[model samples]
Target chain A: MNIEQINIKKSIQIYDELTKGRIINRHIYSSSTHSLIDNPLFQELRENLDIYTNQYQMSGHELIDDGEYFYLIYKKLESSTNQLIKTKVYSAIIVLVRCVTHLQARLYESIKNVNYGIEIKEINEIELPEEYLLILEKAKLGTLDKAVEYLADRSFLIKTNRDKYVLSNAGLSIVDEIVERQNG
Target chain B: MINYKSTIKYIVDYDEPFASLVEYMDQHSVTRVPVVFFELQVKQLIDKITKGTDRQIIDAISKAYALRNLKQHNFVTHDESNESIALTKFIEMFVRNMSEKMRVKPITDKRFKAHASQLTNILNEANSYVSKTTNDKANFREYLQDFLSEVKQDFESNKRAITLRTDNLSKLLKSSEAHGDQRLIYTKIVELCERYVEPFFQFISHTQDKNGFIPTMVRLREFFAEQEMLDEEAEVGRFILNFSSYTKDIQHVYDRINDYRRKGQQDLIVFNGFEKAFNHLSEIVMGMQDGLLVRNDLHNNQDFIESYKRFDNIKADNEKHGNVSINYTDLIEHFKNIEKDLVFSSRRSSQNSPLTQEINLERLALDKESASLLRARNQKNKQLILKISKLIKLHFSSFTKLEEPMDIIGDIHKILSAHMDDYRPFFTLYAYTNIRKKLLAIEKQGRIRVCVGYDQRKTFAYNGISYKYRPILIQDLT
Candidate 1:
């Protein structure tokens, strides 16, 4: 199939989301975006992302699509972006949530879309390593509450209440990426 | 059109046959690159499976990736191992067995499976490709490494795109330097994972027998779970303060019941605050009912003795005061109702209002003195007053000649107190009895006469002699 055969319109829309540093997750987008995803154009773009994105990224940026999401990774490596999660503690929380999501995804086939509310009081129930728990006992600011807020702000997990959270699309994707790497 | 050459090179570097070849070269100190050998193996595997249809090689390779995952995860196809007679024979049998294994319906029934959307449809297609590679063992791993390499490379190199963008996170934190202790914790975990866990199984794909070498990932994760200390739900404490909440409501009901005539019947018509408090108490009793059997039993005999004798006195007095008989059924049911509520809502202490600590030594003494006032709430002595309330009615409800209060107390005291020397001395009830408030409540109702007998003490037969204690009698209003 010729590269010209691909739908230029849908690819551009995906390009817009990716270049803006937004995660182009199908579930989070509008009906138009989702409908476009089902189009043959999107599949062509997904199959040959390097061809389309590289042509478009001649401005010195790169376009990439993981299995479930499409986003841009800056080659220049900006010091700070609005969506950048700065602290290691916050990363730890994301990793923890990722671990749980991976565990559940195995028992389930279509697990990503489902959001099981985990209570805040039940944070200690996730079966983490012993050494990590002892640090948590001493923390005032770096608690699960802090990590949850950081993740929630960026759409990884939704804070349903002061005591419970439901993993969002971004959250599940992060878990998928983490588990793949860890098990790889 | 797909980049099979480089992809095959990547897979061959990491996977079996070619992976073993590369490792073999390293061990033998071969200086020249084995790039040609790797490409030939890749071409040979793809040509064999696709029958010279090069594009279909991608499909075959996709299956190979899934096969590699299954192998790495050590997914078992058969309960027992089948000895391989020949390479072709084993591959054919293995494919047939694995197809059967994959065909089995998922074991657990989920009421609502997550919706299969377009994104997941693609994922499923990919997984199907992976699953189909089960029998592609000979041809699977050759070029499939392209897909794995792409995925693994993307994950390893461009992790930032997949994870949280760190700048957004830095704005909120004081920096690792400010919180040195927390930084230390993060450093240790990251460093250890890199050193131990990440490198633990890097080359296990080349090993045919990994059962003994590769520790199960699940066991490793569990160790990390404990080491990393993820907050688990099971470790949460104190959902509700069970003791204080129970007694606080019980005390409020007791106070309300005390204001009643015949413990609530008279106030059923005349009292203003009666209905609200009565209903609240009923609700409390209803909640307590579920936990009734499990809690410790706590009661004493004084209240039972006084309450029973008072029943006879009310009957005698009613003979003269006209026919204003107390409904024994309602009172008994109420006792059972209240008992149920208190026992079941066993865990309802208000989170905001726990027992306050005494401020000083003086307050401590006062707290002890007034401790009896909150005897039920404090859950001290474990005795329940509702039992006494019910027992008094049960004892007299059976009597044919309970015209006087004296006759009732005599029977109870004879069986319990006067038998200190009897075969089984049965005054266990005498340990802690409380009837002062309940009796006073009855007297204040002006319907029952809870009069203390003139002799404060009476004698009864025991051991062929006499035993003495208090013998109280009741006289109903005439």
Candidate 2:
């Protein structure tokens, strides 16, 4: 019922109307109908249906029927379970930033006010997860030599070249500050 | 009443050898026997067989006792010391006294008459043979003279026949000359055969007949067969080998005539009759060239000749007109004129203006109208070519075999006409080359002089060298 939801529903409605009220033919739902369904439009409709939930935008016109549309929505929800982790990771980065800023603010305010008896309690710890070490090791940041290196070693990326790096275990945990805060 | 001694008895009492061998028994003075006389007496005994009688009868009598049945004569069983006497007695009783008049009757039927006639024929034949054999020298001389005379006569007759043959051959040749050079050469060869080779062989045949070396009847039939043109080729061959030497004669005559022709003498001359049939024959032959038939058929019947003469009475009329020339020339000229007139008349229809003529002119106009159709078609073709060229120029492409458009409608006829002209030259050239090549190859392989194309010289190293002419073809424009 917000603008975002309204746009999504209107977009889907337009797509359905352009496709003559059917986004995918009913024939595509059955395994037996796969070979018989050869229209190039069917493939476009399939790709657009994947983007409908994942990217919130369709690439082409498609006329998918009710059953296929419902199944595609169900599959999108199932696949979007990974999106929850991604969302958690993003919120954790914000949380870490907030924790750092809050600590700095406290120090500055106390100093500016010049209060003699102002005492700070211990700042809450933003402990990175133990699994972060595994991610860092797997990334192989030792021999990276590109501006956007995937952090693997290869001959084209000599060790003496301009350096590049992937996040360490601690950095990875700190970058996920906003994600961790959202999850907590 | 026939006495026993004369009863058709075979005489054995005077058997010399037996008598001589036993004669010593009768003599008191015993002389040693002469083996020579004994042998001579034995020889004489064997020689005393009856003439004009079957030898079997006499042989049976000589070995009489050996043939006697032992069962029938018991007393005369076997005698060793006097075997000759035994044989003598057996012969005297059984064979010497026999007569057969009572058994078989005398053969006095028509067979006797036949036998008499046969005998007479044999005697006459014998007499003739004897006369021929005994005085054979004189008879042989006479026969030789007669043979020589007959040969001479035959030679004369052959000369006459040969003359006739030559005349006929010459006529044929002359006629063939009128026809074509090839036929003339062939006929001239035949003429030469008639004149020279046939006469000599005819002399040989006549001599063979007269000498009885060849039967007269056979020679006569042979001569008749050779002369009989109606006879089949094989039957004619059975007679005196009819070696025509015609080819040689034809060649000789051809050479002579060719020599004359090369010398540019008159093409034809008078050969027979007062008016000279040669010129007429030549003219007729010329007219009959290329297998044309000529019917000149002069007849001996005066009536027909008289009527023909009347029909042909232009001579006197021409003479009166002071033309004084042979009417035959005029006749030929007139005939030629008629032919020319016919040819000209046929061509006149196209040459003359159809409008001026009595025939339908509308058809001609229609034809001319239709004829413009091709001109329009040609214009359309030219336009199409120009358009296609302009369109194709942008592509920088020239025509290819496939891309070129053809008038498929009349292409078959066009191709036919084109191939007719194109193939003819090649056909002629190829035919000439093939025949020339074959002939030249044959010549090179040892055949002597053979004429070939237009005076080309070729040498053949074979048994004997010969020369031949290579004739040239004259250009004909028609």
Candidate 3:
């Protein structure tokens, strides 16, 4: 196949992955995992990034690249779905804070290191305040484990083991932004 | 004769009863112990000390009283009636000094004025001693020493009081219980600063008031320096140094309180922001649950935007990447071909294929005939409705002229029979029953007033079926 055909094939593949709601991170260890930034397909799409972005836009999906990660958002979001996403994000952050506070750990430091795994047992032991628990329950994340699983599914957390999970770079970036805003 | 010193020694040796007594007096801030109450306490103590005979307990009680009344021991003195025993001033001071438990009372303005007056009198006395003899100088030095000691003690106690108060307030402010009520914690901090800490700091550090505690101490230090009494000067210097240190300690506590207040304000702002976001999201969820097509303006709401920005790492500024324009006209056929391929693929995967089905002409003709018949029935029903409406209107027009309440069913039957050459009573009755149902519904909707009564004695027969007759009176309030 010619280079143009190869590029189009790679672009379609990357676009398909993004539309499936999988975050494309800069680093991926295994070649078996084809969605990594280092994949030849990703390199081909990067060479024609603007073309692919415009192509995705024509399809009613906005391609978002924050330098380190890539994701997609619909150009016109349904209001209910948007609100539900916001609620889930807020609930996750609030639960994260409560867990950090219960463990008597610094909020930013706890989430900054990708290798820093929070024990699932310790998270289950945390007794969140009633008000915070109510919010989580309303968002269908009534338990800390469920909230952790939700974040992991969204690529905000990485499940390192059956009982341990570490904050992903995307999650760390969010925490860093929040802390900076609070301190500032 | 009891050796008074040994008696005092004996009282101290039984640390249980005597120590317990001292603690009770200190905590209650009472110097006088009633005789009976004292005996009762001693008896209780003895019972605990030894499960001995009653006589032995009585002896322990007697010894306690004897120790209190010892003339030479002077531990306590009895009143004229001997009903109560008061600790001697010397013993009271000793206990207070030993315990180091000073009552935490903020120094009053009145007391500060008294100190200033006392210092002035001493300074005046020193100034009047012209051609001072050694005896006069000794007396002046003694007086200065006494005044400096008292000032030192007062300052020490005041420092202790401020430390204790601030420490308690700090613990409470940091406690989880206090977090449950942010407003209460805020009020407590404000009250501490306004009522106690600020005032005490001002009273000590008020340089504007020449007779203030700080200025008076400086004046005394200078007075001793003028006399060239090296020892007295050194003592006063040390006093001033101690005073400065105490003020610094209080200032440290004041800074801590300020920090807590600032932190509390920040926490409150954060808490309120989260609460607002949570409430707004909850309202949206509730609206959606109620089947409302709620517009979530959260993305555009300033407060919600601020909250979202805290958690949103992805910046929406996509202008840096150069925009690439595509010619949609050129790709239209290509997109249509891709769409057709997708549709074809999906169709191939299904169990049944739409293209394989054959159309049945016979079924089409039958459907057309049935549709025409249904249309005819609908048209007939519509005409029946119009006739029923006209008859009801006629009945209402002549309502006052008619003697008997209108038999709505009979009237509808009569109208149907007169209007059509061939009319089925069953169908007419069905139409009348439908009219009655509509009228009841209108009444329920509050568009009209209606009263329905059953006349059980009367039966209405339609097609060999009997239904009890019901008469309704409807008032059209509208």
Question: How close is chain B to the truth by TM-score, in each candidate?
Answer: 0.16, 0.16, 0.42
How do the residues B1-478 of candidate 2 rate in per-residue lDDT, one tens digit apiece? 2223422232353344434534532243232334444446555666775776578655644443122332133312334353322223343233322322111111222432333344334333433443465576355434434533443343343344343444554555456423234334443444345445443443333434443323432443443344352332233244334323333343444444344333221111100120222223223323323443333222211222232111121111112333222344666866665555445554444432332223345877988888899789898767644543343333213112323332221222223334343322223233334344444454465532343255454222212533232332221111
Worst 10 residues of 2 chain B by lDDT: B265-274
* Candidate 2 segments whose C-alpha is farther than 4 A from its true place: A1-184, B1-134, B175-178, B181-191, B194-478
lDDT of 1 by residue, B228-271 (tens): 42431111111112223323433343233233213222111112
lDDT of each: 0.38, 0.32, 0.58
Worst 10 residues of 2 chain A by lDDT: A151-160
The CAPRI-style docking tier of model 1 reads: incorrect
Q: After superposition, how far is residue B265 of candidate 3 from its true place, in Å?
A: 13
Sort the predicted structures by TM-score, highest score first.
3, 1, 2
Better of 2 and 3 by DockQ: 3
lDDT at residue B136 of model 3 (Cα atoms)? 86
Model 3 lDDT per residue over B1-478, tens place: 3555655554554444445556666568686766676667666766675655467544644564464345447777777575777767666555444543443444544555566678778767877655689898778778778887876766676677667766776776557442345445755676666666666666666633766655766776776677676787788678767777777787887787777666555444444443444455445444434443444333323343455542232222133232112234646866665555455553333233323333355887999999999999999889866766675566533333334455556666666666655567675566666677677776677766656665423455655876555555555555
Question: What ranges in model 1 sit over 4 Å off?
Answer: A1-16, A26-52, A78-95, A98-184, B1-478
Per-model DockQ: 0.01, 0.00, 0.10
lDDT of 1 by residue, A114-171 (tens): 3335554555455654333332322212555556654554445545423455555555
TM-score for each candidate, following the candidate numbering? 0.20, 0.13, 0.39
Residue-pair clashes per prediction, in order, are 50, 30, 0
Runs in model 3 lying further than 4 Å from the true structure: A1-82, A99-118, A125-134, A140-142, A149-184, B1-44, B52-147, B154-216, B225-234, B238-478
